[model samples]
Target: MEKKVQQYYRLKQKQKDIEKELAELRQDILNYCSEQETNETEIGRYKVKLVVQNRKEYDDAKLYETLSDPEVWRLLSKSDPAKVASLTKLNVISEDKIMHTYALKTVTLLQVDKK
Candidate 1:
């Protein structure tokens, strides 16, 4: 058990080291791209593209508020009886119910520095 724990820690540290190196390399690529003022480039067989994209996301707070309204809730319950029935039967909807959705603005740098 002790040996396994030690090995796990060592592996975790090595993973962190590799992640840091990757981040540094990515930063370098970004710096180079900015300096050159180019969005699309080719290095050997790989084509690198940097793009900004707008992703669709649900507003959970607004959704919950909409659901919480008696009129809207009734409409939803009427429209989707099975969904409301299942959630009610499972006893999953409570004051403590925390529904989470990913609401991240992610910038993708594709195919960076590939040969």
Candidate 2:
């Protein structure tokens, strides 16, 4: 069991290292694209596209107030039933789920001596 835990930790560390390398390579590609002023390029059947996504952040309290309003929800339910249903269901279900009842289990290699 100890050996398995050690292996799991080693594998997790290796995965992180690979992920870091992958991110660096992706950044390098983006840098090259920016230097060339190209949005998309094709190389040996591989197509790379640089897309910029913009988003607006609203105050959660205000947003929730708007969403929870009966009139606003009714309008949304008519125009966008799926979105309204998803938001309403998530709100109700999350409220019913108690966070303390959940247990998150993990294995760690670090040893602590208790006096």
Candidate 3:
């Protein structure tokens, strides 16, 4: 009877562990899905452009900088020699770095001068 009770307790403990693991997995999946949704929204609204021929590259730091930097709008407002040079040094825009874009779009917005 003692052996049976020990076995029952062991089974209960095992079940608890499994439940905890399952809950953790579910939370991880939920977090992943939430992150994906946020990324999609950002991609749609963000102004960073991209030009790609083959597989596109993703640069998280650059993206964050571009999105967060206050100078981003100023850069976009002008496409001049000095501005281009400055942005290149800042790595805000690069020929090699392509934003998340579709196949139809090829050219990224380097600068946008007022009309």
Which prediction has the highest TM-score against the true structure? 1
Better of 1 and 2 by TM-score: 1
How many angstroms is residue 12 displaced in model 1 relative to the true structure, after the best TM-score fit? 0.6
Off by over 4 Å in 1: 44-46, 56-59, 69-106, 113-115
Candidate number with the higher lDDT (1 or 3): 1
Where model 2 places Cα greater than 4 Å from the true spot, the runs are 55-58, 70-115
Task: Looking at model 2, report the run of 10 residues with the lowest lDDT sum.
Answer: 106-115
**Residue pairs with backbone overlap in model 1:** none
Judge candidate 1 against the unseen true structure and give its global Cα lDDT, from 0 to 1: 0.61
Model 2 TM-score is 0.52
Q: Lowest-scoring 10 consecutive residues by lDDT in candidate 3? A: 104-113
Q: What is the C-alpha local distance difference test score of candidate 2?
A: 0.55
Report lDDT (CA) for all predictions: 0.61, 0.55, 0.49
TM-score of 1: 0.54
Clashing pairs in 2: none
What is the alpha-carbon lDDT for the whole of candidate 3? Answer: 0.49
